[model samples]
Target chain A: MACDLSPVLLSVRVALISTVLNMIMGTILAWVTENKRFPGKNLLETVIGLPLVLPPTVIGFGLLLLFGKHGPLGYFLAEFLHIRVVFTWWAAVIAAAVVSLPLMYKSAKTGFASIDKNLEQAARTLGSSETRVFFTVTLPLAAPGVIAGLLLSFTRALGEFGATLMLAGNIPGQTQTIPLAIYFASEAGDTRTAVFLVIVISFISFLITYGLNWWVDGRSSMRKGG
Target chain B: MLEVTVKKVLTDFTLEVDFTISDGILVLFGPSGAGKTTVLQSIAGLSIPDYGLIKLNNRIFFSAAQVINVPARLRRVGYVFQEYALFPHMTVKQNAMYGIKGCKDMDGRYKLSVLDVMEMLKITHLQDRYPVSLSGGEKQRVALARALMTEPDLLLLDEPLAALDDKTRRQLRGELKELQRRWQIPFIIVTHDRTELNYLADAALFLRNGKPYRVLNRNKEQPYD
Candidate 1:
């Protein structure tokens, strides 16, 4: 039957891993850029955001060049700990993550920027430390935006194609994710599998986006009512 | 007595404000963008100036030459932001207790109960409500109660009455004035509303384009208009 669940399962794992890593990195990046004013801050933002504008294939290629076996980073890792990233699950995860970074960063940054600065000032004046203010006030208010960004990033990672393909070749049960599965199925004239996967992915995406909209709408209404 | 002097230069305007308030209301009266709020912000340690100094009861809050800038958490100042800036996610009770620590019940400490401040602010009924669910006046009262919970040495109100309706403003202004009198804490209120200034202020400091244009004592006058 060649009932291939490899792409389905592996892709889900890759998306999950990529989403988690992206959420952490994107949050930290957004917090830094939104709050601090260091030297060349604009430059740093532009550089960090380059992944958004650059082609996904280019990003994959860049990652490959920087972290391939002969690459300095890869060589150091191999010599130190004998870990190979090329054509591995980690590579697929990183590729998807790079493609999805800007989604998280942009959304989270907007969230952080929209928060009232006066609330934090008031907290500080009332004897709350910087750490306490962030956790208690800033994080709570920023949760909705962060959650929205994370979910969007997860969805994008689920559909990541160009970067994933370029960085990690489609090895069945290894680096082959759902998108790759759909592509290979279509190429092989297995229309039933392709159509089924497409329908499943479409249904899930639809549900997620609809759920997000409902949540945001309910949140705003709840706020207004409260 | 709290004497603050700070010289801060924003991109558009330079703020060089100095004043001292021992007791009663020190109204920072100014038109919009006159840097009146900047002065209060500097006092609260929110805005740090490039030069000058701030001293509260002989303790230096900020000293450019000494390179001493006391952080806001240790300053014991109460601030009411122009919009109140209540915590939208928390209930009114949680908001009231937001900045107050529990050290008062444990050992050598001073504290006010959340219930007390809520009752004082007349927000006891709204204790379970969030900021988004609160009316403008309710939010202001909650902000006041939250700031009061810390039992601050000096209170700063940055146009606290600007967001309410005329009737609500008039009503809250009276309540705020009464509260101020009862608390007996020096207050620095930034506002251009002459009505509010006349009704609540004992002394008025007029700011024109980031400078103190004049300082008037309203104690003797029977406020009109």
Candidate 2:
């Protein structure tokens, strides 16, 4: 029997969209947290990093509560905008984004923190606006780490299961991703499809992680050589 | 002319200074932790003082009493950091051209061109090269060129020769003095090297414990050995 490619396609799409969202949100959050000082800054950082330690199911439960029909945000959306977020492909994207965000944020934060502050000050003295200084000097220098973060986020989003299951539900040709499809296939005793998805996910994750390691290593060696 | 009267409390000492500097090279000579760099930073608008004013060429750069504080980008001061602080990802040309894009003269024309400053610093051949491949001396020239691109009213160099070799340091010292004269702008240099202080400074301010101990005019004195 021919393999159904819809799961693979949907998984890739969800991962791609989630990775882009993660990159933007993570970069901004990392910059603000890393450079600015304010009261309760530590609390804000801890909240952003909560997903790293919290179970995916717990996160999914929290999201479900927040986005449920009677919940405050859910009420506003459903009442005003007439949008339903639960148990949809969009829910899959949101679940993957939430779970993968911490990886991107931490990596981007480390990247921004490692740069010399003097370089930014130098740009300021040269009459560069703060936005210009960040875009021109700070962002470019931190690119390698940011790229690695993006890769990790994509892989993490691709492999997400429990959160997607709780928030989006496993519906064929709709919210079903590779991991969820594998789970359902095995439950139905379709070992062939399950094994095939497992191999595909493993291969994809292996390539992404291997590329990240190679890039990080090349960057460090380039720095040392220079 | 630049007039500075400010006070800032550091962990080990308090920096309090009231001085006016006119044309020529003025050196802040002090030990490492004596707050020399802090003084330069204050003048460049990078650091805020507890109280007092900083006036450069009749422009109020900062005034705590009047609550007037010009941001660093509008201060029109060039700061060459000790390590040069060149942008590692950019070519020398890009770094030199950075400030030129934002600056304009009275007629609304761009004040200085990148090629002009690069040629002045003798780095014309190295414009396409990145900072990572440049020697310390080349990096210093690129930094100076980048700073000069803004057409600053004052130039500040923090430990300008600290990162260079002995021979290169000696060579750049004469070039630096010539640059100040040619540009006809006030240049404030911070350094702990006695030889550099004696050789390049038209006057030197001796600082100890974040206070100005004395001011010496080198016009009539022999060089310190």
Candidate 3:
């Protein structure tokens, strides 16, 4: 039988979109949490980091309560915006973004914090406004961390299974990403397709991790040489 | 018309200083932990004085009484840090030009072109180089170039030449004096090196124990040492 490639395409699409979302939202959140002082800062930090330690199934359950038809956000979206997120590919994207955010946030924050504050003060003495200083001096210096976050988040989003199954549902050719497809194929005793999907995922995961290591090694050596 | 009277409690001893200089280089000569850096910080608006006032020309930088504190960004103060806090990622040219705020005639605002400043500091050839590859002297010049580009009314240096070798330090001493004369701006240098005081000080504050024991100016014909 010809292998169904729909899951592969769907996984890539979901992972790509979610990674972009996570990068934008996560980096901004990291910068804010790192630089600013405000009330509930610790609470906000805990919430952002909760996804990493929490079970994926538990996250899906929480997401379900928020996105169910009669739920608060779901009700407003359906009535006002005419958009429904539950049990759809959109839900898969949301799940991936939420789950992978902490990796991005933590990495970006560490990168920003490692910089000497004097560099920023140097910029300030040059008449650089706070916003300009961030973009010019701060953000460029933190770029390696941001790129690492993007790569990690993409891989995490790609392999998302438990939460995707619960929130998006494994609809064939639509929301059936690689992990869900592999599970269903194995459950049905379709060993051939299951093995093929497993190898594909394993290779992708290996490549991502290897690429991350190579990048980090090269960057550190480059810094040392400079 | 620069005037300052600052007092702030530190970890060990209270830093109480009151001095004024209209022009020329004024050196704060003291040992480590003597609050020399703190005094420069206060003048640059980087640190606020607990009580007293700082004024340059007529602009009030900080005042505990009036409760007025102008932040460092708007204070028009040039500060050269000890370690030359140049942006490692940016080239010498970029760092040099980083301070040039909007001026159609950049010559008129800062009273010198960016290229001229780099040339005067003799770092024009190293424009494309990063700070990491630069020698101690080159890095110092880049820092001075960056600060001078901003056209600050008063310039503050915190052990600016401390990291340099003796030869470079001696060479820069004369250059700094010439620079002050050409720029015609008041300078406050924080250094304990008596050699620096003898070579560069038009006025000097000798601090022994967090208190300025003597304030000597050239017009008074008193020896700095």
Candidate 4:
């Protein structure tokens, strides 16, 4: 019998949406924290990095409280906006975004830090405005790091399973993702489907990792770009 | 004409300097830590003085009492840093044309001409090449081209030829003198090289340990203003 493909589609949708969120929110956080000096900077950095080390169940528990119909944001969202997020696809997206943000932030920060400061000063002396300099000089130089960040972020979001399972639940066509499908397929003795999904996910992971390695190797650090 | 009477306090010592220079090459001759670069930075509006006045051609660049400090971009001055400071990502042509595109023509005295500056500095052929691909002398010329393209009223060159070989250094010294004569702007060069002092300086002010020690003139009579 042909296996169900709904899990694959739902996984792709969640990963794509989460990756977009990671790009915008992660890069903005990196730029702000890297450039400015404000109070509680250390605290902010710790909070950003907390998801990297936190247990997925713990994160799910926190999300449950926050969006469980009567919780603060959940109450406001449900009452004012008529949206419920406790066990939905949007909750899966939020979980993936929160988990993958630190990687993107770290990568972008490294990219921005590797830039030679004198180049910025040179542009300034040449009469370019700060915004102009950022677009024309800063962003281009930091492209490699930013690209690396995006790739890593996308991969991390794709592999997200724990928080997603707890928050979105295995709702078949509505919220069943690849990892959840594989687990239930084997548990229910559906060996053929389980084997197929395992192979597919492993193959995709190998492709992403190999591509990332090759891309980074082609542009090693301190090698002058002409 | 430019007049500067500025005092800046550094960690090791205090910097108190006073001078008045006109349209000629004025060399700030000093040792390593004598705050020579600070003076150049102050004149270029990159550094703030503790207290004093920097007046150039009736425009107040900075004044402590009058509460004025013009930013670097609006100062109508060009600064060529010691390391040449060219945008590594940009080609020679882009670097040379950087300051003149968006900004208005500076004060209507010196025309904005990238072609003239590039042709005069002998960097016209290097328009498409990046900074890393260029040799030391080529980089220096590109830096000069970038600075001069703005047609600034004051050009600050910090150790312009210090990184070149002896032959290239000698060659650029002569070209710099020619460029200075043609530009006719106040060229304040910071250098410790005695040869540069004799060759390019129409006037020289020696600095020691963050203070203006003395002033030597080739044409003017008095030392201090």
Each model's C-alpha lDDT? 0.85, 0.91, 0.89, 0.85
Docking model 2 quality class: medium
Provide per-model DockQ scores. Answer: 0.60, 0.74, 0.57, 0.57
Candidate 4 lDDT by residue in tens digits, A8-125:
7787788889888888888778878887899998999998898899987787778778878778989999999999886888988887888888888899888888887767776766
Q: Write the per-residue lDDT of candidate 2 for residues A1-226, one digit (tens) a residue.
A: 3388889999999999999999999999999999999899999889888988999999999999988998887889899999999999999999999999999999999899989999999999988889888889899988876888899999999999989999999999999999999998999999999999999999999999998888879878988988
Fnat computed for model 4: 0.52
Who is ahead in lDDT, 1 or 3?
3
The best candidate by TM-score is 2
TM-score, one value per model: 0.92, 0.96, 0.91, 0.90
**Which window of ten consecutive residues has the lowest lDDT sum in model 3 chain B?**
B101-110
Query: Fnat of candidate 3, please?
Result: 0.66
RMSD of each: 3.1, 2.5, 2.8, 2.8
Q: Which stretches of candidate 3 lie over 4 Å from their true place?
A: B65-67, B102-111, B207-210, B219-225
Share of native interface contacts recovered by each model: 0.82, 0.82, 0.66, 0.52
For each candidate in turn, the interface RMSD (Å) is: 2.3, 1.2, 2.4, 1.8
The regions of model 4 sitting more than 4 angstroms off are A221-226, B105-113, B219-225
Model 1 Cα lDDT, one tens digit per residue, B103-149: 12234555677887788888999989778777899999999998888
- Residue A178, model 1: lDDT of 83
Q: Please, what are the lDDT tens digits per residue for candidate 2 over residues B1-225?
A: 999998999999999887889999999999999999999999999999988899998999999989998989998899999999999888999989888755633566556767788888999999998899999999999999999888899999999999999999999999999999999999999999999998988888888888988887865643332
Residue A109's C-alpha lDDT in candidate 3? 90
Give the Å shift of residue B43 in candidate 4: 2.7
